[model samples]
Target: MSTAISEAGNIPVNAATPVVTYSPVVFDVPGRAAPLEIKVSAPATGTDLPIILLSHGHGETNFIASLHGNAPMAGFYAAHGFVVVQPTHLDDKALGLRDSGHPEAPMFWRSRVTDMHFILDHLDEIEATVPGLAGRLDRDRIAAVGHSLGGHTTSMLLGSRVDDPEDPQTGDLSDPRIKVGVILASPGVSDEPTDGVMMQRVRMLRFINFDTMTTPALVVAGDKDLNENFSTRLSYRSDAYTHAPAPKTLLTMHGAEHIFGGITGFDTVETTDEDPERVATLRAMIWAYLRSALYPDDKAWPAAVEALESGAATSSGTVESK
Candidate 1:
């Protein structure tokens, strides 16, 4: 595949080679009361294809935070030869777990990580459920991609650990099976919680630690995403990239915001920046990053970085690596 980013920010999708999608693929979790539901999308043809476990961001909208959202990104990845699997976490508004008093209520951070792990463990069953998808997935090459709160989930799978103040010796939940990750608009490290209702709603953000985040990842953040409710500075959103070790990259979108140009859905009201070109740029960059990270010898990542630095891709973003 070429490393060039088209003006429209999309690689041509062959209409004849359509993508197939399956939703609500049920899998029973051993300790969970409800079976896990997922949406699977893949190219009509291809074998041993890489897998992308897409974790949806928690949003005010009921369905956007569930397996039903992010069709634009998922469809793009599927069309580009990746098997994308998105799970509806217990925290999804559609489940109405708020009044149920679910143990992982509120953030449901731990359960979110477990959801991704459960999906990886049941890939065989998931593939079998979809017609013509059997034995087509490259189990060995897997990556996790997430946005916002979902990005926090992706970080844990990639070796990031959260220290429990109450239990100092708590073990890390990092899953070794995930080879790489891409974190978009994820929460940053904070010494203390922000004042007011935002703190009560997202209390878990203050305890995140990036020292143990050893996996190779690409951190994408927006310059104008000054999420005042979460942090005092806009740069706070780039913490995942600034604090992580080498073999990590930071893609700072110049005029972007939390939604990153409507990636959550097509023409959704949540998008503060509605530039389709920006979304396309994000798609192209992510595709290049995943390709090169999965294969050391692949030049797509470096080439794409060069394009960004040289202003060939677009002047709206800048990239840095350590």
Candidate 2:
């Protein structure tokens, strides 16, 4: 392992400023079945810290699918100079909305996008909720990151749109506030289940259009993330990178699975491929990508890529860009 890519890729972790986390910062949204809940994590001391809006996946685990999930990712980003905020979308398993007869039951795709916008709209309030965090965030340099279904949410925030048949108002839901994004193990543009089980299962996925996803992003997929419940196509998850326009990067992790080495939570049963080292390196890569994307002059992305290619970071993955 090379010290070239410090603990957090190009950004070295400072032992002086420890990580701090606060949770359940509630917000009442009209028309929403339940109040919105969020968790925030950041360094104890930092000014003008960049922001990362982390969206959790709709996983099998109860708490990991909500604001309490992705501790590995949120901790890494926060420890390495980024203020991370996570929202518990309406589809959270703990909410039990799947059988509520709501039109967007199960996935609640549109509300997921709305939650991100609501977070951005009320950053001031969110900041005040956490002690010593007010006026320390760089509002202009915010990025969105999502895993699995949350990946679709991040893509939507980055410009991906859905032409939903059930919802005629499903127009462009892209937000200019999000400068860049990371999509991990998310569904791709596929017609494999044209009229099959998946079409009737996750119907919204059938209409996901990446033609207009023009924002810059990094799409990550595992070589072994084959879930029979979804499409069996090996390239199904990486299609977001394949179909999206230029200014995108794809990171294919060797031997990794849907959880990308246990990103949802530490030692959780949801992660079939539970390798801590893989999780650490993946965190570094994501941190580097977000840093470089937010600051064009930053050399973190290229340095991290070089480290990975040179076997300094690890031999577990390969990176390609358009």
TM-score winner among the candidates? 2
Global lDDT of each candidate: 0.82, 0.87
For residue 109, model 2's alpha carbon misses the true position, in angstroms, by 0.9
Query: TM-score of the candidate numbered 2?
Result: 0.94
Q: Ten-residue segment with the worst summed lDDT in candidate 1?
A: 7-16
lDDT of 1 by residue, 1-322 (tens): 7465443253222232478999879887888756799999999998989999999988888789989888778988888778999999887888888558776676677888999988888888888898899989998889999999899999988877677676554458888889999999998887544533455566567677888899999999998898767877788778888888777899998889998888898788888888777887787789889988887897877777776667766436888889
RMSD of each: 3.8, 3.0
TM-score of each: 0.92, 0.94
Clashing pairs in 2: none
Best by lDDT: 2
| Residue 16 lDDT (model 2) | 29
lDDT (Cα, 0-100) at 271 in candidate 2? 80
**299, model 2: CA deviation in Å?**
0.7
